[model samples]
Target: MNREILVENLIEFLPILYKKFFKGLDVCEITKQQFELLYCVGQWDEKPMTYYCSKMLVSKSNLSIIADRLIEEGFLERNTLPEDRRVILLRLSEKGRGFLCDQTNKFKKEIINKLEKFDENDIKRLNEIMQEAREIVTKLD
Candidate 1:
């Protein structure tokens, strides 16, 4: 198969795959964008609003609105830096962590159940192909 065609296929299907994977599974009722924010914020102990803006490739104004909504939804909390009160940091609340963990477990169970139908050789081949794809993707990063 042509590499360009393969890349185009991935580009077209990746969003579909993501939507299928995550749809109807957000027990906390957060939007996909909000869930992404929660996931990024939860990856670290805490991060400044600006840091998230850059990491998420969103503007400060946009991030502020998303952050505000997550805060209202009890998925995130904002705090001021002790040394610099002007700097605001975002962190996942207890509810946020619980939701993330729950979603992760759900995904794990679903994936495992789906994979169990395949034989060991098929699983190994899938893993090898996925690893190759991962390496290609990492080059873009």
Candidate 2:
């Protein structure tokens, strides 16, 4: 297949996959944007709000609102850098970790249930393909 067609297929399929995994998801009580922010903090460790603004593609004001809400909800906390009081660091709290773990397990269970109909060979092939895709994506960084 042409690279353009392959890229197009990925673009098209990714949203379908996202919807399958995230649509109507109720494992967490947060909005999609909020969940994404939590996931980013959980995965990336301490980072500034600007970092998340870049990652989440939102304005500082918008992310601040999201961050404020998350902070209020006890999912995330901000710490002023001791060196520079102007710099703020964001990280997930224990509650946030628990929430992430619960949501992950829920997603895992849902995926496993969906995969039950597939044969072992098909599942193995899919795992191999997914790993290859992950490697390819990692190389883009």
Candidate 3:
């Protein structure tokens, strides 16, 4: 396999896919970065701040700034681990979960609209392909 071509295609395809399906969707009042943070927390609830910094490839200070805004907005909660008071953990509040659900629904609807031209068979095949792709990609981690 041509690994260079595969890398180049992924680099080009990912942004295009994101732009078509996720970019510019209504995220209530939060910035895109804030929404992404919320999504990450929603997916990995009750994780330490360091986890987010590592997963998102952001600095601790930058993650703190984003977390602070989300906390003030009532979408996230910060807590200290009972066993380790110095470790700060983040989780989504009820409001954050609801907001994330709503945003996800909106994104799904947009993607559905874009896929309307595809026949049922094509859609099914696409779903299968995507699942296979996901399984293959997860090996990178």
Candidate 4:
């Protein structure tokens, strides 16, 4: 199979690892969608709604709906910049942060455990390939 197909398959499974491995307690279970979105937005301490829409390749209206749901669930908050009240910014809530910390730790452990099976050369090649992919994506953007 081509490398892109392999990457696509891996992308599909990354989110499932959270539900199947990182079990959340009570009503806090992170839906695959929520986890994916939070994974992107959490990178920015605070970011505009437009930023998320563009980054996730979703329509603005769709992003707005998801953002609203996240805010209602206490996972994220919508705030307006003092200088730009017309636009909104997204930030994760305390709940979101706590959840992400656990998720990140679980994700790291799982990933490292798998990667550790590979020799150092394989790990180095993976990093190099990933960096090349990032550079290609940057140019495309």
lDDT (CA) for every model shown? 0.84, 0.87, 0.91, 0.78
Model 1: per-residue Cα lDDT over 7-93, one tens digit each: 899899889867755555554587777877888997865888899887789999999999999999898999999999988999999
Model 3 scores worst on lDDT over the 10 consecutive residues at 19-28
Give per-residue CA lDDT, model 4, range 1-141, as digits (tens): 698997897799768855654554223465666776787778975888888888788888888878878888888988999997988988989988887888877777776766677898998997898899789879977
Encode model 2's per-residue lDDT on 15-62: one tens digit a residue. Answer: 998786666666557888998899899889799888888888999889
Q: TM-score for candidate 4, please give it.
A: 0.73
The C-alpha stretches of model 4 lying farther than 4 A from their native spots are 1-28
- lDDT of candidate 3 at residue 27, scale 0 to 100: 76
Q: Estimated TM-score per prediction? A: 0.76, 0.87, 0.90, 0.73
> What's the count of clashing pairs in each model shown?
0, 0, 0, 0
Q: Who is ahead in TM-score, 1 or 3? A: 3
Candidate 1 lDDT (Cα, 0 to 1): 0.84
The order of the candidates by TM-score, greatest first, is: 3, 2, 1, 4
lDDT of 3 by residue, 38-83 (tens): 9899889999999988888899999999999999999999999999
Q: Model 1, residue 27: displacement in angstroms?
A: 3.9
Candidate 2 colliding pairs, count:
0
Cα displacement (angstroms), candidate 1, residue 6, comes to: 5.7
